[model samples]
Target: MTTVLIVASNVPAQPAVLTEALERFKGRGARVAVACFFDAAELEIDPALAEIRSFAVPKEQIDKRLRTALGRAPANRKIWLHAQRSGWLMKWARTADLLVAIDPRSVHTVWEMAQRNVAASACYGLVPALRALDAGVSAPVTTRLERQVSATAARGVRGARRAAISSAKTTLRKATGQKVMGTPAGAWLWTRAVSAPKIPDRYRSKLAARVHDSAVRAGRHAEAARAATAAVSRITNAATRAELLTKAAQSELAVGRVPERLHDAISAQLTLADSLLRKDRKRAATALSNAWSLASNRVLHFDRLSSPLVDDPAGYLAPFRASEAARLLSAPRGRSVPAAPVPSGRPLRILLATLINDNFLHEIRQRYEAMPNVEVRFLDLDDDPARRSLARSGSSVIEHKLAGHTPYGEKIEEWLRPHLDWADTVFIDWCQATAALFTMPDPGDTRIVIRLHSFEAFNFWPHLVDFSRVDDVVFVSDHLRDLSTAVLPQLLGAEAPRLWVIDNAMDLQRYARPKPAQARFNLGMVGVGSVAKDPRWTIEVLRHLRRQDERYQLLLIGSDLNAKTSVAAKQYADLLKRDLAELEPSGAVQRRGQTDDVPAALAEVGVIVSSSVRESFHCGLVEGAASGAVPVVRDWPYFAGGAHGARTLFPADWVVDSPAQAAERILAATATEEDWRRSGQAAAEHTLKTWDWTVTQTAFDRLFLTD
Candidate 1:
């Protein structure tokens, strides 16, 4: 068997690409294994594949150590530390038949690994991996010192520019913090304490902590805050007040102390979050967490001001409730003034459309688009800047998320109705604002269908869906349906319309690849960027495997954690990065970053793991399974206990909890190379037979094509 080992960075797109290759290779008895750092549990794999395990290297632990070291070290030494660690990473190199990198950031590590693993052919992207495999030879490509110098210089230029910008931000934040919190009394203590030279670095943080506490205890919060601000302000530090405030808030909350100037804390953190979000939106999630912690503070609810939710639900929630963010979370509905028959003109020009994610509508659109029976117009909410409303919530752009959709929502209805009036049916994707807006009123004679994905259940959009106008609600999974029903009982109310669970339209025919000789050893996961897509758990599995044998390593795809965006995000990112750092250099895990192709990445991944806490339908895992990667599922804690979840989505043998169980399964499957190859072929067949778009599109056709 020509064995293929995919070194992925846990990108979400990996599964789809892999599934395609598995189909082609399986009939030929090729072996495949996917080794990655992120979780792929959400991807419900076909049971035919061998059991999959995660080769995760907990980068968070090393990152934490690095952060601790950085916190203690002089700023000049950070780069030196990173360079010194390259020597520490050589042990994890893989001698796979093929190596594919899923992201750009991971290219460096992959390049290093390829240098030592001369038997392995390395390439970026699933397509590239496939090409390398087709070449059937491992050619050693070397990077000379001159080339490294050029690359380093280019990177230095980029880093220099980034550092300059970061310095400016830091300076501004420190200045703001000093102005906002500095007090003469507290300043006296800080000035003397900070100026003391040659004090042990270890004691520095503790000393600073003592001074801060003294100021707080003395009822000089502003003074204490200002002191820290002053210390940080002048150094062109990127860490700003919002970051400080969050740290302060976290400490206070942990000890159960609320900031005296709660409003100041909230606003300061929010403003900082806004600024950070302007640059990097992902980090804004933490800003929301921080804001929530503050707003949900007892003082705001009971200690002082009356909650807007309690006082005036309509007016208070106006900012949030009226936002496109909230609207996207709801079901679709039409107005009370509805009953109109299709006019006796041209054939019903049904307009089946959605905002952007048309996963469910692909087949339905094609069917209707080809229906000689209708006229069609598909609108992506993101296509028009005016219509897109979901920005990072509460980042300075919150006002935008709130204010941005009102007119646009109306314009949508205006632009859409004419087509609705012209045609008969109008299908919208996601129960998001697109659905809400389309159903804002009666669509003269048009029938409307709105699909509900998993996330919209946790949010507010389902509450806004005017059931009065909606004709159908489509769901991808049953657990989502059950949870959504409980979350929004309005569906059980008089206005509720028809709701159905339709599988997503995925063309999974490509899986069915031959396994390589060492296909039994690798474990893979797809997607690792979000908190929801937890990669840490996968690390635990790898840890388990190393205890048995150190042959396993994880591969992560996607951007590294960016905590600089918000305190909450930073905290989480910091933790995750720490986990990655420890695991990465040890060769226990590899993070590749984001990529477009998956089949090539899957070429090397023998096993696939899903590690999400929650999900709608983890298309990634299913795609991985289709690619013939042994699918190991986490049972999906978010949707596990529900009626429809990972259990119902995939065969029972595939699901498990904890990394130990995952390791046990991987060990058993890899016990023999022959055992591994058969399992992979079976999985590829299952994915191709079950989830291919040809099969799923039928469900779509039934949902949209039916009267």
Candidate 2:
């Protein structure tokens, strides 16, 4: 009997196709063994027909550190690494006459298996598997040495390619790493080298990224930017140009700075997107998706100190907004029926949904969950692998939006329609993928409300949300609402949902704690993981204050910034670390690690500083104020001169323009214990009255309780 092995990374979408193909293999007198990453029990195939087994490594079983290290490897390499760890797969892969991959994700596994078992026929899909079996029947028998020789020859060829690439990279890095590149002449020479003749496209791109990275490390941002622009301009292939420009742009973002050539990078992607649209809409959507991904990357636009989009939203995104394909994706699809009012005699079923970041929902969920008249269910879209994959399927989402029909659209309906059916009202937090997916399908009578926090305004997700289908679109602040509406034109349309500004829910009553007299000398900043938080500015404030009063010190609360999040983050973190090393030993600055009790942490903090370059709302400063700390809010630069800003959001006395002003205010506010305590009392009363859950919940209740 012939032996066959099949590997599937996910459950087959159409099991009938797989079952029919299996029946064909069995009719040919083959014994089959199936291995899948998902549970075998989910499959309906007869056990007597084939021996099925699961190759899934449970979450607990996976070494997270190892998985993270393997994450950077090629998809095929990662698949092989995981599969090789399974003894059952190794055994079957070696002896099988044929190997099959049920899905695209599994194709890598079969590809690796093919390399190992050269004698066996390997292919993807049912029809290809069937054909492989026939080819195997007529294949000439191979000796063990022949198989080994072929495998060794393949390895030699792959090794040679890898070695050649490695050598080229090493050579390029050395030539570009010279200090001479700091000057214009040197930069021009290196730029020419990158654009030199006989250089392969792959090598040239890699060289550009490496040179830009090295130049940035050498602190030559302008030089690096110029070199990348020159090299990209020399490239003829639009896709390759897009890739190189994107990589260069990402390098700048990695260090917490905007790319000097961000406009060029974005334009290249839009150009490519438009090019692809003429030939294939799906491909065009994917290109637009790539462009959006680069433009909306959190490190560059949201998590950083500033953004080009915030500077000029329409101008920054002019290329994308001009693209016909991007417009199609943003085109509003109105819901068929208006949301039905909450039934008077029955409990209202409300579903609170999000992909991740449920920090804002705790109070709202607790309130609804405790209410007798309301039943609440929370759906975290990222909590499930299936939904998570769907949420991240940017290309598929674009295709669905452009075509008005796709497998992805069907899947979204199948997965989310049940929740829509059950809930009288659906509140989606964060106008990201969850909001887009929820709004993709028509809501028959269910109310759809999506809340856009600060970050989503800077991302492509808000553009993807079909505002016409939404009943209420909420923002945390007027500034964020203005910014979001400015970028997403759909929100401005007459058919758009009712816009509302709802402050984030916070239980500030708990933060009303007394502080020690010495607390007046301490300045505290909560949450400093992103470069935008501008913790360095707080340090500058500390330095400025300490010169006058040595008693002044800064308390940096929350986890240290994670450099691995982006190249920009890593660069910022490095600079911060060096600065911290100098001040930490002298007690001028202290890193108070993350904690659950912000009130307790703030009790020792007399002055709470909002040194962020930008914010929708400085919740941390408010929390600190609620804890009896004097508030010192920086005039967030992004929105400083705009229609709405930190100045408009907070009392004028609390907002400062510069570090010197912040230091001046800090000194004046805490000049005496009485003045400090009095200022703290006033700020605390303001936050409690304006933003506390006690105050905000009423607005929330009106949103849900009112028809």
Expressed as tens digits, the lDDT of each residue in 1-707 for candidate 1 is: 66555444555565665667555545445566554445546444543442233444345656776766556555444433342354322333443555555666455556655554556667777667666666664543453344445556766785799689779856644433444224664457564564366654334433444455555645456666655544433323233445454455544433335554444445554554555555644354355446545645442322221233333334433433333333333434345455344435665555656666665666566766776656677777667675465311223222223333454445556655566666566667777656655655466646777778875654444554566677778888888788767655556666687888877777676654555665566777778655566677888888898888888877665566444433344445667778777888877787767777776677678888888777788888888888877888888776656567888888777888778888887777767777777677777777777778877777765664556
Candidate 2 per-residue lDDT, tens place, 1-707, comes to: 78999998888888887788788889999999999788888889988778899866776778987576476567656666788888888999988988888788888888778778877877788888788787663345556557668877987898799789868856766777746566667676776677777677777887878778767766788778877876776778888888899888877776667788887887887788778876777777877777887788877665556777888888988887887778877787787889999889999999999987898899999999999999999999889875689888777888788788888899899999999999999999999889989989999999999998888888788778788889998988999999988888778767778999988999999988778999999999999988889899889899999899999999999988877877667767888998999999999899899999888999999999998888889789899989989999989988898899898889899999999999999889899999999989999899889898999999999999998
Tell me how candidate 2 scores on lDDT. 0.85
Off by over 4 Å in 1: 1-348, 356-364, 385-413, 561-565
Model 1 sits at a Cα RMSD from the real structure of 24.0
lDDT of each: 0.60, 0.85
The all-Cα superposition gives candidate 2 an RMSD in Å to the true structure of: 7.8
Tell me the TM-score of each prediction against the true structure.
0.53, 0.75
